[model samples]
Target: MTGTPDAPVADVRPVVRRHHGDEFIDDYEWLRDVEDPDVLALLEAENGYTEARTAHLADLRETIFGEIKARTRETDLSVPVRHGDWWYFSRTVEGLSYAIRSRCPATPGDWTPPAVEAGIEAPGEHVLLDSNVLAEGHEFFALGAFSLTDDDTLLAYSTDLTGDERYTIRFKDLRTGEELADEIPGTSGGATWSAGGTHVFYSTVDDAWRPHRVWRHRLGTPVADDVLVHEETDERFFTGIGRTQSEKFLVIGASSKITSESRLLPADDPEGEFRVVLPRSTGVEYSVEHAVVGGDDVLLLLHNDGAPDFELVAVDLEPVLTSPLASARDGRVVVAADPGMRLEDVDVFARHLFVSYRRAALTRLGVLDIEATGFGPMREVPFEEELFSCGLGANAEWDQPLIRIGVGSFVTPSSVLDLDPDTFETHLRKQAEVLGGYDPADYVQHRTWATAEDGTLVPVSVVARADTPQDGTAPALLYGYGAYEISIDPGMSVARLSLLDRGFVFAVAHVRGGGEMGRAWYDDGKMAQKRNSFTDFVAAAHHLVAEGWTSHERLVAEGGSAGGLLMGAVANLAPDAFRGVLAAVPFVDALTTILDPSMPLTVIEWDEWGDPLHDADVYAYMKSYSPYENVQERPYPAILAVTSLQDTRVSVVEPAKWVARIRATTTGDAPILLKTEMHAGHGGVSGRYDSWRERAFELAWIIDTAAGAPASTS
Candidate 1:
């Protein structure tokens, strides 16, 4: 901490990659071979150097971590969700790093959940899985598939101890409290139990880490005896298996970025042959949900066949079973597509239907009563907050008259409630306990628009302390993720309060690549329009400064994964627009990663990003904006790149190579630091405390950098 520490110098072995009649030289490509001893040594050295550089901010990190912990209720229980004869819930004890899954008996006529509180259990509570116990002796732990049989007597759960997505499935007899001998390994972290409780359906990943095969495992059979029920031959499509809410049909679905296909088999006949609900069509994506409309069984389809924003249609189940090539478009139109609304999902219960969609740049939910004729009028759920996130919760029972909904905003704590089908009245279940005299009134959230260079207005959600002055003096953080049609909705975070309390304005830029507005927004930001995502982020930053929210010196940019690519591009395009950049598990070397078909997710990503390997224009376009390739000899902002060595999504070598090139090429005095979690995956360090500490470290760096103080010097 006394003097500036020398940055770790990467050994460069230039490798020339020729694609589409173009040759590009890449240094540090050898780092991609993570098994190489030299690569591991380099990563270790980088971590050591980063630790030395940020040594002075250790106390600040602790203070922020303490603030996060103090605000969050350490011991709490989630609202129990009633499935069948039991109300299932999870509990976290004080100082515990994991949650304990437990359930209690449910009364036949009583729809009300038992009054369960933290550090307490309901009557006849039976523990199903305690992740803390299973996670012992591991640096990382994640609970994957937690499913119960229709009879509620058998349980199938999966666990990942190394932070990787692959899980090992296990079974238990809830009635006898005995752990069964059945265990399935190397699965894709999901499992669906057969209605009769005799078999479980799960998916396994291929060498590329894609869930490509669906397997059915009998409870008493060996792992090797599991049947490969379905295999997705296309590399672009991933397969998933699950049961309908009615528990009447088991569904195996396969989908790519733009197209999807589903096959259904009756749950009563686990050994029966699966029939196609709809054939896969090019550029058409649809999902099927089994529903009983007026006592007649039907398949409700949410599809984007000709509708850009998607629409809802209902087809008789018998017709889909009889005709394999039946198109959802030929069925009865339940809800016509609206250009402004992007239909996401539909869940049907015995007497009602829940539809989740995004309209006016916000997620909304609507409920419709299932009348004998057809369906009742749609009743949209109302919320007072102008900017908030709301979605469906655990509504496992088809006959359950209540629907659970999770709602929250940047200033509001997360609240879970149950909506009654009879009157659309919502009953409060539980709101997150934020200790230390926290008040939502103390903070304010604003929805503003930033005009991009093309005159397109991009939405930005800003949250700050109510008393904070907006005179370009307060340090601000601009966050963005503009890829994969993922929406960065407004959700409250306890850790984020540390920044707001410290006079930092947090703004999320809803760029084009995201599905914040609609499907058109995402389409305009991906593939050929990918550059729009980065430019929109830069525009948002300029708007914040112009609007007197924060100055360039007091502003910091943050993003992860694909958003990390945005950070890198903006750094090159508008280096003076921000004070610092934090890229976590970034995809900086986009051209390199996507050009290689052998890379994990490379082929699958072609739908989002054009296949540069096969197309000349795509290669040229990606090369033009590839962050690693575009590094120039110019002043740059302070940068902190975080990655996980075990991450199968974005390889650790990307950020490693990016940091190496930036440090070598930049003329700026700012430090470019790299931190790699050796024992974790893309999620970084697992466990609540460790995750908090990791966040604390990043927040401290952001605070220091925004103050124009370099935490590290190189």
Candidate 2:
């Protein structure tokens, strides 16, 4: 069952693709308004809807797991290993039956893969069946990197088994591997170890699932009655858990939204009042995002005080620790030193602390020194940027254990290395077999700007050929997610090579509603000014055409989620701007989207997208440009709109409903196809290859539509 093919570009041009203006009002039958405000309200208040959705997700999870397990049966892969000591999920590969190893020791480069060769008579992978998931779901069992205490008595971990934007917290004892304490706490999980190792402070969603405070938990105590070290009552002020030396630091912010925040709270006493580390009311002075808590008065803060590139600042913790480290991850949050290194994943370890920076793409580990050192100037530790994924392990096997670094780039298979802070030594443990096939350097990057209709300049970053042809017609795919202050910076994608290899130019429009340019840029691109984003995308397309990099006939615009709204609005306003419109899980009906807050995330997302239901004025603003309701009879460009039936964030019904309307109203026969993933959430598809293959599907469609290539194997 291959996917549907894209319409050829050659067939699209000379078709007179142009913007639809008010002059076309008398051209065809206008859309009949059948929308019912009362019905939408009823659908939300009905709890039956939530139950049905939950049941549907469970079924989808089962189907996906069954399909994957069945396909890989007899593959001799090791059952995933859970390392409770230094919280990590690992799989070791020997000859056949790849052994899975987790919770590596704090000893540098001394990690032993699960094997009899470790010469230790202890419970290991061979001794433990991969039956962790065999029993009923362990709501507490977290996936990915985690940590344990020195005696392996207490364990801390996270579980996003379902990425509903929140991870549940679970504390267990390795001696029994039975969960000791579990807390959903109606919030996203952020567990951090306290200095005494008896209690853990973690961040979570509040009663309404809004980010509110960081709570504390005893090692084996009941999940009830968790202490609140720090709580932010302000709807705008949000808090989550991060790691300190012993306890989790309360990461405070203005909004839980990405790249948003102003302060942090590191509580030394999880059960006690928290002292503000970074002032939350710093107001507009600083735009603080994510932070890392280290020793004494040391803290690693990521902030853009209205600057181009975010500047990393080190703050003394003693002055900031008026309170305890309130945020939580595992048993203990390790701080990092400046000269330290991350293997490649999301972990950081150095001399004294293990640090984790959540917002920025690049992270570094630094040694901590309180008063003697004047921020020794934050230095970058060298690690292979390309072939490796580095991460840190907190609540590891030791009290002051060194960071366990996993290093290996594309050329190199995954390798384990322990980094020692005091000794400045990196020890090599084990390396996965070569099994060579892929290589890096097949990609490149370029940056440029385009001016919009209102004279607003939009920046675009392109990743394509160093030797792109001057033929001025290389098929290009321009992507942007320009809503809600999210910054789409330069990122590496392995699958992007699919289009690049086939000679397609990949570009990212750094439009408004995104922090690419700064706060002003974000402010200008949001709310009533959102039109700038759509026009910004269009201007970029026109810029490409004018620059001869790619013509409007050869250009295609793509965006997903909120960005999907951007794509649709642009396509709606300028049908002839691009060859194809690729939108995924889009919130096309913006005004209605915010108005129906009960519709999944409508209530929670009111701050991002204003609530139209609350005010008639807002509704009027929304009706001014609701994509679905605005779809009129016109010779629009070919479009591929995708959604997921299982998506709780943006329901399949939104895109489904939009596609039906678009198909019904368009003047031309341009295909308006709907591709829904029945098994995924806001994020489409799971498993790596599945994601790449899906991208391939979209790429094939875009190519055929924009370059006029043969349609995909529909």
Candidate 3:
């Protein structure tokens, strides 16, 4: 690869799209045709340009990749989780690309995970499915819907060979070590089996890639004879199927951004019609879990009915099934929503209830004991770290005495613990092994506040080497993902050490569009207030600079998907704020995609971005900050837009068009590069090794750009 290469120019075919009395011209819209030879050639040329431009950093990229590989334990086993008669876990081999799912026979009544040494396999281990073997010949492979029957005699799994989300479902008879004759195609990647293991329920996506239908397949029956049990007609709603913790009820759930409806059928009665537990109402989202309290079947409902942050309520099972809407309103409140905490989810066990919530931008887990005294006080599960992510792990059995919890932070490797509700004691089950001598003492992680334009305080998690200077002279990478009420929690990464070891500070901007600060934080950043996500990100960059952590000349902004949209918007909104930008599968063409309801996921995203095609106000509001439309003739920072040709959520055309337009419009000579993965999806390449290599490439480019390497325009 040479240091200098001519930038490819895309053929401009102006396509006019009009909505709400507004007209927009998309110059490179024709690039959406993925099969076009010219389009492929253009993408290939851009990839070549990127390779030539970054050829000087090849050694650095390899070094980073090596560091990542060395730090990771190539051959390891996860903590074994006990379910019924077996202890199940997954193991990784040295050269394999995927995990080998296996299980061992359990000594009845043993709730504790089987203790196994780092390199030792468990006794009597039987391999159920080896993803490495399944993915041997596939370039891109994703395993989904790994479900087992109650009897443990059969296994059902799904796989997606292409980047598209559609998966194929297949069954295997564990006893015979052979795949069954039944094969189902094009599913939503989830399956639930009846208690008797006689029937399996799965969901299928519509033309828009929305899971809209649920079907039941009796064992040994042909695919054509499968019964469609439920179908959600609302374009905004998605459907899924799952079983309750008690394994008594098979649930069909239909949900949108703000509304939800659930139907339940006895797991023993697979052919029975499902009865609605609650009717869907606008702006009311609720989830239900079944439990037996005081010898009576009860339904625990977590809903945002009167509390925006959500609250927990309990109702008698029969009453809820008889008159769901009324019973839901009359239900007794179990845990009222607090301003400082957002009730995220509730998992019910036979004798206790576990609740997971977010408080002050950190995760917290609480347990409620169910005894003869009705219900005990909600006890908080404690963690030592001031900044870490903790949540409930796999606790599949309802009669289990221990609760599984996972905890980790920026400097700490992930650890699994088993908590005894009776004694309030936790037993350390396993902690991820960092092979190449990792020491937490060498690093520092902390939280800092950034004041948004609207006077809202946003939390930013920053981690760096202990010896790194605070004099604003070091390079920094600021990451942000502030959409869909998703919180970007601080967690440990073996690959990230490559940056910190090289005198770089890594920070996560918990902006308004994220759930870190609660539901209100997310509400304040979406729809008409969407610009807050971008401005809040900019504010975080400024805060880091003002605090002497790093300066604009040494800063690189990074985000993917909606956050990638953020990278694009910030480039247009505050071009001089960062030295470089790395956007992966960016949703840059917001207004254009959102305006076309016919596109995949367009209608489903209306609740988050608003219906830009129908509402003039929404159209104008989105148009004001739509990155592609707002690009100006300014000296923008160097940009590396990474995308995949087979991405379904955000089309590859988005970043391709954005890079083309930015290159054509920006006055700066800073290189604008696009790298499209021909055989990957939204999450990029599937294998761990492939993913690490990709990260090393991106980080190397970032490190180079921060060190003041201008694009070679020769």
Candidate 4:
């Protein structure tokens, strides 16, 4: 398996797969066996080849890593949030790789975050959980659920040590600093406590990694005795449990991609049966929040029942929860859906409602006063930035006077703001500490539009040095993720400065299948129209070249997960448009994965990708654009595919197989490398330092490839 960079070959063991009268041969299908010694050997050989090919850029990788470390404040404390009698927060020590969760007594009438200086721990801080200690012996550790009881005496938390999504939940007494015997394993990373704190509800995943069942665990009870509260048998729907904002009911929600059904159990009645709020409809999606309007218990429903975008409506809880046929449309409309804006989410407070929406490809927050006269007009939360991302932060308390929000742009570091609902005045709690000198004036951030093939204007956000000449000579990195209606917003990143300082321009393509423009934008890029996302990205690249931002020889494209799917498609669609492509945990084998229902998350994803297993039309449509099946014997950009051995979302084999096929089929001499993390999940490494090193390695490769440097040999 060990070979030179120019001719590294993977042993081919062809597997024939047939679906809908179509046949395809997968030559590298044997790479799926992670436990096989030969498969492991091949992965190691590929890793060695990648290392040998990039050994020349070792200095560059270190420089970038050092720049990132220097810019970030190693020792810092987050804004302290006041919950009940405690002002809870987390802080990072200079050398530690994780945060220490702590809390102190809250001062009377003080709703603002406590003032804490950098590098100094707060007085009387009670350390609840130290992630560093928990992660000390494990190669991968993720702190999942961190829920405290209403009395604040006991803490319930979950941990995943193997990078698998399954978590083990444990209880600890905050006052005595003693661990409880109530250990629950195989949870789905969330736990909601009853009002009496005697019982807690948690969810568990099925073999396919879909959260399928909710269970009730009583204090001091044996794990075998825990009751199964609700079970969702439908594979298409995933289930989750949470307490409503009013703290009156426990919500168990079952949802597929397009439809949702919620069951409510009163917080006071821990042994009561859960009742459905509304029956699930084929194409309707809605979320419910408990609220007290006009002294009546009402449910605030954010639904797209009739409105394509989404509308906020007030439904009488008594009727909707009691009747199976009652729909949210029978309720009074509060905030009617607007064609131009897409309502992303709604947060309910005691006296106000915070609505997060997107318009003109930017996130905006609006506050509405919940008064006796229905609801007041929504007032937009003011942000001065021309292109930035802002949304609600951690507001756990239902009746808090001030709402916490996070705001940042490409050039601006993230800042925590406390906004007053009544006065609309925002108080800065803390701005991100960049240790090395950082000046927002030294960089430029702006939005540009590219005309797609269908003449649709697509948004592109670009950031570069203020004085960098847009002469089509400087190298550029274009990133895009257009799936699941998820928006890749403009946020602060200290690691990105390394590229900007090196005369590289960075841009994000707000293509369709993303919520940047609106729900319509996402609708236009998903299902049968999914090809629009890939083509839109290519159009953005062409626009960048035509507008003198960069040339085809100096452009590098990147994306991860579904976005990685985007990278693979674009590489096949327009290979000459970029100098290199970097895909992380890519879903390249879409057709094969979607056809197998047993694959993790395959059934739950049918709404987004269409059901290809049974429908021949969908099978043919997906087959036409599926990256692995569509790979042609043509010149391709320098490609790097990175995956993780433990990733269940997009299997590691997808990338391994895709890389092998690309390397064997492409006619060009450019390097096609595959790097797999042997002990990580969908998200790469767990620790901050490990993640930084991985990113530095990637940026170094992109810089080297964009510079047209020849691949290094052992």
Candidate 5:
């Protein structure tokens, strides 16, 4: 594998795919016509053979992109947050690639926040929409829908520019800074307004990009007289549109990967009609929030019906806004199911409700107190970092007398405090500065576990640099995703401090299809127990190499989109445990994109990967772990993958056909590669110094393949 650069083969055209009686053929399904010019010249010859095999790590990718732009503090700002009589924030401008939004005024009762400083602006600030002047000439820019009104005098944003998550919307009028002729176009960047800010609502998608309708518009409108309001014709549901922080109702919602529904109306009756509330079932899941309690109004919800780590309850919002289908299952429990806590949402706050949940695998938060009998006791909210990650940040004012929260931890950096809720006190308000002189007690973080050959302990977390080395001569990484119950929690990463100041280590795993340790550890790793998320990520890489902390020849593994299908099914299930893998944007041709429901989020990922096109034992349990139908021949570790070609969620022909079938079915010589991003999408290169030079070219190929490992043949 020395300076190897030749690999761009992928042109096979077989294509047979016969369901359950299972015929399967497929050879690079013609790299799914990414507008074929030979699939854009084979993704520009696999991005020029991954820039000539990483041209000997171009000076270690410009010294890890100048140590992530010198420990990043480049003109920062964000903390403001008040909303209503203004305060909001967002700055960043040392050679800005985007982010400027502004606001200022708020002092009516001064709930404190104001420090402002950074490149100095504040006193009546105002600016509002500068995303570096709308990401000038876009090679991918984002910000979809910003929203405003509750007398902030109209703003409603949105703008995508081509990372294909579609969005366009417009409007502004912050009382004369002018701009609204009301634009609209394609949408789904999210919007919601109405309390007499003259109707906005939003949502749109379809053509398998999902979202499916919602609409409304109005403020001097004509986007063909807008109005639809609801649609979600079940391509396994999706739709959305929000509002209620007691600005009184708007909601909408729809959801699928395990059912959900909602509807509501009256944010001052935007032409009133909505209604529903519960009516959904099939493996029920719930969410809604709005509260009032003593003067009775309520909703709260959270639900996972018979609670497999979910349960909050408390319904009766005037009989679901006066009966139109009122069915939140007769409410009244307000946080019960604690099979080791998982709950997740509920924010309300006039006199407090917050919540958020997760417990042992971390991310927690609590508050409660809106009692005239209903919610008084919760309270938890403490934090001194034992593997941290706190929640509920920008408290947009529903009688905001404090409570922002944010926190962080793999050796902490993200920090934002405020709390109070009538004296649980806490204050802090800003921590992320980290420039080169950085020091989080020189890093260290903890939690360990592993187990899982079906017994299942899992957990992991780690972090390093407190003079790195838990014995096995350090060089770890690890990471993992597990799938939809999402949870890869413990945070902080200023480009992961160029791999913990070079001795590496990192970690994460937590395995079992993720919502960490709850919802029955994501129903035991999804669909027919999805090979318990690839043998719980190969039992957390053989328990981080039998606990010496690293050496399976210096371990690497990583993940992305469904944890790049758990780094392509643990490189076909533990290809000699590691030395490299990466996988960003990788859903690695999972049974030809979940047996194609015309793709794009494959019918709401059949309740988190199952109905393999009408289940023949979920097409033999997803063709026995579909990482490009289990690429074989043997030995494979050095990989990379990354992707984009306008990724409408995983499809740069599934990592250009899984790096052309692992360089034609690898048997050894481990150099795989791929790259792609031709003007990005699926969150790739959208400028923050081109995403820190794409994380310094994937941390200079994970520090030259973990310092080209190959020693402990133990």
Candidate 6:
């Protein structure tokens, strides 16, 4: 043995990829020969993931079993303690399924999920919302809405939670509690009545997830009206512009973008051909927003003029509806958020036009309560965070006015409140609970800025116990969401209370590509700028260490799906930054997954992460960080990667291959385990108890690894 003071000689066993050092090429060729990656090798890998996940679950199950007992302590907890991809399942009481509880939080008193004797299986004894759950146990939730008629005589509803975003409308008579076939396409939403419920108008989506023509349901027929009100496809404008929550205005873009003529049609003329609205300019890009007013008042349409810019312009329906439809380009100003960042949507209710920026970010909720000039000074309802989305008028009740506010904070549970606009006071309507005696005050909240590699500032929110020691080595776990314009905000969770009680510093990294700072922030951090997001997360980890928030040896990082990819990539980029990494249903093999169209969510996300195969630029950039293909025989954090076998979204094979590769390639003995569920979809678990058991398993891993035990003995 060479007596080298610097290097302590030790027998090193390489991991992850040593065996397949040269076999990958030949195996890969065979895979290409059949053009089917569902090979025997892959199958074996899948089994590996199952075994690892099973053992890990067993570990977690053991640790959390005692913790799962219902706490008799009256500890009031607020917001979510942990974060994960989830679903809305039924909680039954006695034998009745009372209300629909989403994986989302309850808005205080207004939407408290009914108490259920069935525990999490079915819930009951309160107001019920007829929304679709993940019934088939898939990754998708169906589209449905519940509305009570003015007289409460009829309960109008639609029941298509998944097949199409379009709903199928039906009515139930309260008197008999029977179904009434108020047959409607259920696609064109907002089934409002015409004065005396003569007809109900609605909109629905087509096969491609695009909004189709508007349809009206007459009081008599079991079928929708033969005549279409408006076919979004024929509007001489693209229909899949945006969602109801985010899209604001539609601008007939440049000729190159549209390729055809642009048009505007009157609402009354269902059979009318498209009326040219503006000349199609080659390569033009614009957006439009329309607000429909009641009865005699004309509809207000807003258009953005400058390229990548926004200018509020209005079109009066009274004049445009009568005269061949006026060009949408012809309008007056209402409001504008920016020119570069596209405006997402506008909500117009009695005397208020709430404008939203970046779909819904630091939402201004600018209420232009003006008939003419000079709307009131914009009321800045602060908290104004990116992780949470705030909306108005979820319910029309006077007691919870100030406009009904629906708010969700990262780590905080979702809640809806009634606010008196005049008083700006918030009154709780409904809220979500895990039924445990835990108080939010038991945790501390703090915000700090971390400097990225390029010196850019990233904000982080940390929550921990009040008496947390500044010992710099607490088992701190940091989470992040840095892609697809999603904000990681407040949410409530039952799984995290135990973690908090044990002194875990739960933090969220509000990195780039999120609407946290408005459009600019998101635009700057996505696609080509995607590297910034990964680095930003790394910086947040470094900041935690540097500030004694959590040190390098004790810091753990966790992320799911896209965030999981973030955690995986950052782990590869900086192995020493964390002690353990938990990636749930992560897109670790980004490039390969995106290149395949068969994957669930890929086809729908081409716009977000550009198609890789056809575009070499996207391929190269994605390859720059995809964790799976980039595996190296280097040291890595003890990793607990999870995925579901039945997951129709992110295929289970992803984690399978990733774990094997990492296990074989990495040098250190630190365990890199995969947990795959055999009978679940993207969520991995069916019931609350099952989910708690899985969560407890993860916490157990954290406890064992962070506390210095065999990483994965089982």
How many collisions per candidate?
A: 0, 69, 0, 0, 2, 83
Error of 3 at 485 (Å): 0.3
Relative to the true structure, candidate 2 reaches a TM of: 0.67
Q: Per-residue lDDT for 184-275 in model 6, tens only?
A: 65453335433233445456554444444555556667672444555544322333211121111222221212233333443333244434
TM-score of 4: 0.98
| Candidate 3 colliding pairs | none
What C-alpha lDDT do the candidate models reach, one value each?
0.90, 0.53, 0.89, 0.90, 0.83, 0.56
lDDT value, residue 411 of candidate 6: 45
- What TM-score fits each model? 0.98, 0.67, 0.98, 0.98, 0.32, 0.70
Q: Candidates ranked by lDDT, best first?
A: 1, 4, 3, 5, 6, 2
| Candidate 5 lDDT over residue span 1-714, tens digit each | 565767778768887889868797878787788887988987888888888988878877887777788878789888888887878898888888888888899889898978888898889898879987787877889998888888898888998888888888898888788987778878878888889788888888888798988988778968898889789787988988887777788888888988888888878989888988888888888878788878878777888777778788887677777674444456888768878888888889777887788878888888888878788878787787788888888778888778788888888788888878777777888888878688889888889898989786899988887887778878888988877888988888888777877777889888887887877888888888878988888888888778888887778888888888888988898878888899998888887787789878797888887888887988888888888888899879899988888989888888888788878988888678888888888879887998898888887788778865322111
Candidate 2, residue 402: the lDDT equals 47
Candidate 3 achieves a global lDDT of 0.89
Question: How do the residues 168-267 of candidate 1 rate in per-residue lDDT, one tens digit apiece?
Answer: 9999899998999998999999989887899999999988888999999988989999999999989999999988878899999999999999999989
Per-candidate RMSD, Å: 2.2, 10.0, 2.5, 2.4, 24.6, 9.3
- Choose 1 or 4, whichever is better by TM-score: 1
lDDT of 4 by residue, 1-714 (tens): 245455458898888998878889889888888899988888888898899888878988988888888888888888998888899999888888898999999987779777876677677888899999999989999999999888899899999998888899999999999999999999989988998889988999998999999999998999999999999898999999998877889999999989999888789899998888888998999888888777788888889988888999987787655665377787788888999789888888889988999999999999889897678899998889999999999887888889999999999999999999899888999889777778999999989999999999999999998987899987899999999999989987888887887788899999999989888899999999999999999999999999999999999999999999999999999999999999999999998899999989999999999999989999999998989998999999999999999998999889988999998999998899999999999999998899899999998998898875322210
Candidate 1 local accuracy as lDDT?
A: 0.90
Q: What clash pairs does model 5 have? A: 145-158, 560-564
TM-score for candidate 6, residues paired by index = 0.70
Between candidates 1 and 2, the one scoring higher on TM-score is 1
- Candidate 3 residue lDDT tens string, 213-246: 9999998999999999999888999999998888
- Scanning candidate 3 in windows of ten residues, the lowest lDDT window is 705-714
